[model samples]
Target: MSTYEIALDSKAREVEWNNAKCDKYDYMISVFCGLSAGIIDAFFVGTPGKGRLGQWTDKTADNMVQKIANMLWTGDKRSSVDGRPKNAPDTLEKAISYLEQSFPVNYDARYGKDLINGNAISGMSPLNHHLLSLAHSPDIIGLLFSIIDQFTGKATFINNGKLIRLVPVKDARNNKVMYMQGTNFESKVFCGVCNWLGHLISDLCGSSSTRKVGKTGRGAGLPIPFYNLFLLMDLGKFDSNSFADIAVKIFEEGYDLRHGAAMAIPVLIEELSIKVIWALKQHCYAKKEWKDCIPSAKHADLRMMLLIGNATLCLVDGIDAAIRTGIKGGNPITFILHLNLVAWARLVMLVFRELKIRYGSIVDQAVGKYLAQIGLNDAYSLKQYYERMNAIDQKLDSVLRDFTFKVEDDYKVFIQSLNYTLNSSLRTPEQGRDVSVAIAKKEGVKSDRIFRSQEELRYWLGEKK
Candidate 1:
């Protein structure tokens, strides 16, 4: 086949080689790994508040907030001896307060009444306003809205199946106009990004005001990453609450970024356990190369195993959530709160990805077979093709070298004879004719042949057709 065809075939083989198949053994092992992780999730990661892992994640988030607060704390309110800010807001609440004062935004509207006029956003309250407001999300959506709010001096909110933008009521206590800092565009972006991050960090746990009030409840906090997307999904109605309302309720029940982090634990456990086992099996049992044993998503076997494993985990989590919620009189909100949304989301993604890969593989196999039937099959392996090309190149190089050496030697001899003839007497007509006859004999032509013109002479001398 042609080089191009060979190259295309080689690439197809490479892809096929990478997409390793999963056997029944692999699937069983993956299920076991998933079951182990699901058991941990059901027992340790029970619900938002009641689960031990959830509490640990909450404490970890608090510590993270405190550390961030300490970093953002620029006030001279510190004890000289211990280096800890003494009575100057060292706790998470105080740190949040410092961040609030340092990076204040105009969009601190809590309720619909907090707007300039009457109620604009229905059901808007301190508890759910953050969920409705895109800026309060601890993800890319939040970053974009935060930057936009900072520049436009307007707040953006989504509520009651609508997106609303409004001029925020100015804080009469602090009349300072919020402006983007820095001299250049890049510096301004930097300042905006820093401001956005600081603001989000401040709101990550809960508002400083709410925490300071000493209310022992899940106060308003930043939503989980990308959880704001659910606000757009206002279709479903579960027990009089729309999907948006359910999302709000979920956030209200402490399924914020901290709890999201907690939910990640069991998902991660299942993912890692499956990957490790797959890699080990590939290397030890399958006798694959170390490099080939990597559990990348490109491998069909690994993807399938991961799909099965995460599916099992989600299944167990669902059952657990159902049981817990059934005991609580089958409350939908309780069921959602108990469910591991992270695992379910992962399983959905895996399903789509696996379907896509399988579809592509089927198409590829059909195309490959058709091409092979048409005699377009690759004849030479990549290595064999390269070796043959190399041999041909070497042979051509040797032939060219020999031809070059002969030309050089012939040129030298012709030049020396020309020089000798120039120094000697001019040849007579008879001598020139005799010389032509001798040249014809040397060139293996008939010496007695007569030539009429230069063209005829060239033809007789075998120099032209």
Candidate 2:
């Protein structure tokens, strides 16, 4: 048994024995936390179009877009008469326009017709094309596709439950050219990446045209991160639209990244509230150490509480959606719009986490029972045994090393004595014969079987024969 194995076993045992107990009070607290979060979600994040939080997120996104645009702005810096830099974007709309002209792509298809290629992309339009195009997404998938499209002069889009690629055709009359402009491949990739980011920022708060119409309506914005992936799920039928179509419709109606941010607020509140409350209860009521009071998921009680809390939150959200949509004559779009996808996602994650923890516990318990039957259940005893074994192993290594040195020293001494005897007896044959006979007796050999003369002895010892 190695020290590493012993330590690992000790840690496993500690984890198994230290499982936190959740009482009825814990469950009640979790439910209360969830209810509180649900109320916030209902009041603040109602729907994409009219939710207070959604509006706030939209403004925040607009601010972010302006900031990013200003950073990417590289036009002439000459000052204008108004003291503002010439050709510089001052507002969100101007910033968006600046980006549009800076990073023009060939894949701006609208209404089933490619803007550059003149190819067909069914179910695509200015309103929902961003949702259908993978490159328009504000995620890694989008970044990769954006770079690829720039290099290939083609666009990738998901339409009618299939992937579509459209290549641009040359127009000799206009002769308007667009390509990733850089000195090298690396520079070109960098330019592509920048172009992708700049374009997404321009579309973050909606197109410049929509912004020009003022704040009376929700403008078309980029879809939520990875939300475009929903297009692959071409399952289910709601009214006349498939699930994929419904997803696109949802995005077109203001359920974009800004609204997704709004939806995250309640989920964050629920998570933080539970953790803070759990920590307070542990430290104040339970009198636990500060380190132990941390509400980490590693603690069994914390995991269970989180699972219960999120589940309750989802329940509340579902009921609220049901009631609100029912009042609107049970419109499918209304119901879908009112639904809190973030809460449901959190609940699902908690459920899977709880199941995994329970399964692991079961396996650990079975193994522990078998170990206990063999009287090897004590971690301390096992650790001590391994420690002792390691000590003995180190001592044995030292002893063997010393013994080897001693044997080598004794052999050298024996060779020196033999050489001395051979050199001294070289003058007398009889003396050498007597020495040989004596040496033969010591080696358990008969005198007659051994070398007799000095020369013969010298030959036997590897001297010139």
lDDT, candidates in the order shown: 0.76, 0.77
Query: lDDT score of model 2?
Result: 0.77
Off-target runs (Cα >4 Å) in candidate 2 are 1-18, 74-87, 115-119, 169-177, 213-215, 360-465
Compare the candidates by TM-score and give the number of the best one: 1
Residue pairs whose backbone atoms clash in candidate 1: none
Candidate 1 local lDDT, 224-310, one digit each (tens): 788888888858788988888888888887888777777889999999988888888878997877877776777877888899999
Output the worst ten-in-a-row residue range by lDDT, candidate 1.
Answer: 415-424
How many clashes in each candidate? 0, 0
Please, what is the TM-score per model?
A: 0.70, 0.69
Say which candidate scores most in lDDT. 2
Model 1: CA > 4 A from native: 1-19, 74-88, 171-179, 213-215, 360-465
Model 2 lowest lDDT segment of ten = 168-177
Model 2 TM: 0.69
Prediction 1 global C-alpha lDDT: 0.76
